[model samples]
Target: MRFSHTGPAPARRDDWQTLKTLWPYVWAFRGRVTLAFACLLVAKLANVSTPIYLKDLIDGLGMPSTQLTVPLAALAGYGLARLMTGVFGELRDALFARVTQGSIQQVASRVFRHLLALSLRFHMGRRTGGLTRDIERGTKGIGFLLNFTVFNVLPTLLEIAMVTGVLLWRYDWIFAALTLATIAAYVLFTLKVTERRMVYRRTMNTLDSQANGKAIDALLNYETVKYFGNETYESRRYDHDMRGWVDSAVRNQVSLNLLNMGQGLIITIGMTALLWQSARGVVLGRMTVGDVVLVSAYLTQLYAPLNFLGFVYREIKHALADMERMFDLLGHHQEVADRPGATVLQADQASLSFDAVDFGYQADRQILHQVSFSVPAGGSLAVVGSSGAGKSTLSRLLFRFYDPTAGAVRINGRDIRDYTQDSVRAHIGIVPQDTVLFNDTIGYNIAYGRPGATQDEVIEAARAAHIHDFVASLPQGYDTPVGERGLKLSGGEKQRVAIARALLKSPPILVFDEATSALDTRTERAIQDQLDRIAQGRTTLIIAHRLSTIVHADHILVLEGGRVVEQGTHDALLARDGRYARMWELQQSRTAETP
Candidate 1:
C-alpha cells in the first residue's frame, strides 16, 4: 500500500541522451526513410517554383503589347506547380508513416517488458498510477519526436535555405542577410525560452502523477475508506495534489504565449525590411513590378516555416521531459538476477533444507537468523510462530525472492542459487494466507495455475478443492466474475479458489501458508481432511497459527523471534510441556469457550 517516486532526479545533462535511444528503432526502416527524404526534396522544389510561375504569369498578362490570344500555358503551369506541392508533401508523409508508428510501438513495448523483468522489491516500491502515466506520456513522446524531427524540422530548414538563396541571387545580398539573421535570432530565442519553460511543465507532470496515485489508491481501497467514514478525507487529499498542477499549468501557458509573441515580432521585422527594399527598387525603375511581387512571395513563403518552428521547439522540449521518466524505469537493474550460466532445477525427491540461513530486508532490520529446517522426501513439516517470527520470510526465501545474507538454502544437496529463478520456482506451489485474484473470470484465474489445462482438468482440480459444487451452481458457472482482488467473492470462497489454483499446479512441493485461516470451523476441518489426503506423496511445508489445525503434522517447529525454540512431533512437544504446549493450551481454552 506504500507508494513513492524515485527522488533526487538526474540533472538536465541526460535529457538529450534520452531521445538518442530511439535512433536504432528509427533506423530499422532505413529504406522508407531514404524514400521519404527524396519526396521531401521534390516537395520543397515544387513549393519554391510556385512563386516563380506566379511572377511569370503576371508579367506575361501585364504586357502592354500582347497578342489577342490568351496565354493558357502560363496559367496551366502556375496551377500545376501548386498542385505538385501538395501531392509531394502527402507522398512524403505516406512513405514515413511506418517509421513513426513502428518506433512508438517498439519503445513502448520494450519499456513495458523491462518493467516486468524487474525484481519484486522494485515492484513493491512502485506506484502503479505514476508508472502507467509515465508510459502513456513516453509513448506519445516518441511519436512527437519522430514526426517533428523528420517532417517539420528538416523540411523547414530546407525551405528556408532555398528561399534565402533565391532572394540573394535575384535581388541583393541585403535580402539574404536579413532573412538569415532573423531566422538565427528566432531559433535561439525559442530554444532558450522553451528550455526555461520546461521546468514548469516538469513540475506540472509530477503533481499530475501524484494526484493520479492518490485517486487510484483511494478507489482500490474503496471498502476501507467507506468503513472508516473517510470519503471526504480522501477527496481533500486528491484535491490538494491537483491544486499544485493547476498553478504550474497556468504558468506554463503564460510562458508559451510570451514565446509566440517574440517569434512573431522577429518575423515581422525581417519581412518589412525585405519588402521595403523590393518596393524601393521598383519605384526607381531598377526592378520590374514582377520582381517586387516575387520578392514579397519569397519572404511570405519563408516566414511560414519559421512560424511552424516556434511550435515545434516548444513541443519537442515537453516530449523530451516526458520520455525521461520512461528511460529511468528501463535503466533500473534487477537486484537478484541469476548467475550467468545458471542451470535448471532437477526436482526429483524434492527434499528441501535451509542450512543455517540468515536474511534481512535492510542492513539494520534482520528478519531471520540462523534459521535451519529440513523436509524429507514425501514428508511434512509445520512451521508455527507468532507474527514477526519470520514464518513468511521462510516461504519467500524458498521462492528465491531474496538471496540469503548468510549460509544457503538447498534442494537435493544442491544450492538453490545454482539454479535459475524460473526453474527453481517452477516446482513449488504456494497457497498464501491472502489470495488476490485478477479482475477476470473464475475459470481464467483457476487456469492461471496451469495454462492450457483442459476443461475437465480444471473441473477435477476444483472438485478436489471442494469448490466445484459452488462454482457449478452459479448462473455463469465457471465464468463467474471475480472483481478486483476477488472482492466480489466471500473470504472463504476466495480461499477455496486459491486452493483449486494451487491444486491445479501439481508442483512436487506444496506450501500451505495458513491456507484455511478464512474458513469456519466446520469448513476448515473438511478442507484440512482433503489437504491431508492430498499431501500423502508430496513434500509439504505447512505454516499455520492455530495449533488444532496442524496436530497431524509429521514434525513441528516453534519459532520465537527468528530462532527455533522447540522441535518435535505434535505429541512429543505437548508431552514435554514447553512453549508449544503452553500455546496449545491457550488455543484450546479459547476454542472451548467460543461455542
Candidate 2:
C-alpha cells in the first residue's frame, strides 16, 4: 500500500537547528541580502538625521526676537528627509523580496522532495493533514523571520543607539542614562514574558495540527463513517479535540494581552519621566521651550521602532516553532535505501527468484522462513495460500520494497538489491488487490500507468481489460472524474482499470496479486480468459488466495505458515492429494454454496 521513497532520511535534528540549516538557502541569495543591508543603513541614517533637523527647526522657530527665525527652506528640507526615510525603508524591502521568496521556495521544495524520497514506513506513520500544515506554517514563518529580523529588529536597535547619543550630546548625560536603563528593562520584560508564552503557543499549535489531522482523516474515510452510521461519533471526536484547542488558544491570547499591557506600562512610565526631566530643565531656565520639544521629538522617534520591536520579536519566535517541526520531518531517515553504486536493473531475461529468503515486517514476526522459489524466463508461477500465509510478501520481495533479513531476491540472475529501485520497479507491472485511484478523471488515472501515453494507446489498454465499452457508455466517458480513491467506480470497474494500467505499463515481469478478487464469477472468468491470453510466454508471478483463479497455472505453490507445502502443475498437484488439493476443494465448495 505504501509508495517507495528511494533516498535515505537525513539525520534527525532539533527544531531550532532548522534556522542554522536554512543558512545555505539564505546565502544563495547573498548579493541581494547585502544590498538590502545597505538600504537598511541608509534608511536608519535618514530616519535619525530627520529628527535632528526637526530639533534644529524647533529651536530656530522658537528663537526670541533677537535670534533669526527658522527658514522656510529648512522646514522643506526636514519634510523631504522624512519622506526619504520611508522611501529608503520601502526600497530595502523591495530589494530583499527575492531573497525571502527564494529562500522559502528552496526550503519548501526540498521538504516536498524529501517526503517523496522517504521510506513507506515513515510516511505511513504520518498524518497527511498535520504534515502539510507543518510545511505551510513553516514557509510562512520563513517570510516573517526574514522581514522582521532584517528590517524591524535591526532598525529598532540602530534608532535607539542614535537617540541615546543625541540625548547625551544635546542634553544632560542623565537623559541618555535614564533612556538606556528604561529600554533595557522593557526588553528584558518582553523577552521573559514572550519566552514564558512560548509553552502556550507550542501547545496551541500542537492541538491545531491534531484537530486538522483528525478532520482530514475523518473526511477521507467519509464513506466508511456513513456506512457504519457513526456520523455522531466522528462529530463528537472532532468536537472533543476542538474544545481542547479552544482552551489552549484562549490561554495563548490571554498571555499575549498580559505581555502587551506590561510593555505599555513600562513605556508609559519612561515617557512620563523623560518629558518631566525636560520640563524641569525648562522651568529652571537651563533649557528652552524648543529644547523640550526637541527632546520629546527624539524620544517619540526612538519609541516607534521599539514598540514595533515587541511585535517583530514575538512573530520571529512563532516562526521558529513552525520551522522546527517542518525541518524535523525533512530530517527523517529513510529505513529502506539503495546500496552504494547500484545500477539500473538490466532485466535481459526477466526471470525472478527468491534465494532462500527470510523476511518479516517486524523482526519479531517473520513472514517468510527461508522460502525459495524461481520462475524461468517466459514462464508462469502461481502462489496460493491462506490469508496469513505471506502470499503477497513474495511480490514485495521481488519489488525490493524491503530487504530480506536473510538471503536475497534476484532478477535476471542479479540480486535485486544490486540494481536501482526505480529501474527494478520500472521493469515490473502489478495489478494489486485493492486498487486505489487518485481523485481525478478516468483517463488521467488510466494514463498514470504509462505517463505521457497517447489517447489511442489508453483506449486500447482499456479495451484490452474489457472496460472501454462501459466507460464509453458514460456521458463524460474518460473525462468523468472518479470520486476520492475511485469510490464512484464499482469494484469490478476499479479492478479493470488496474488491469488496463498494468497492461499499459508493458513491463517484462508482471504480478497479478489477487487481480480478479473483486470481480463477480462471470467477470472473473471473462478477465481470466484475457489474462491467460496475455500472460503467455511472459514471466508472470501470481499471488492469489482463490484456488480457482490459479487452477491452470503452469506451476502452483501452496504455502502454509510461510513455507511452501506443495508445488507442481495443477493436474500434477491434484494428483498428489496434498494441501493444494484441499484448498481447491474448499474454494469449489464455497462457490457452490453462494446463491
Relative to the true structure, how large is the alpha-carbon lDDT of every model? 0.87, 0.86
The Cα error of candidate 1 at residue 509, in Å, is 1.9
Alpha-carbon shift of residue 563 in model 1 (angstroms):
1.5
Kindly report which residue pairs in candidate 1 clash with one another. none
Positional deviation of residue 224's Cα in model 2 after best superposition, in angstroms: 2.3
Per-residue lDDT tens digits for candidate 2, residues 1-595, read: 3232212212333545767888899999989989888988888887877866776687787767887775677688788888889998998999999999999999999999889878766777898887899899999999999888898898889888987888888889989988998899899999999988777667767767777887899899998999999898778767766787788788888988998999999989889899999999999998887788778888788887788788888888888877887887867976778889999876545988888889888879999988888899889999998999999988877877678899889888889888988999999999999999999988998899999999999999999899999999999999999999999999999999999999999888889999999998898999999988888877999999787888777788888899988899999998999888888888889889999
Q: Which ten residues in a row have the lowest lDDT in candidate 2?
A: 1-10
lDDT of 1 by residue, 297-395 (tens): 887787886798789878887888888888888789977888989999866559888899888888998988898888898899999999999998888
Superposed Cα RMSD, model 2: 4.3
TM per prediction: 0.94, 0.92
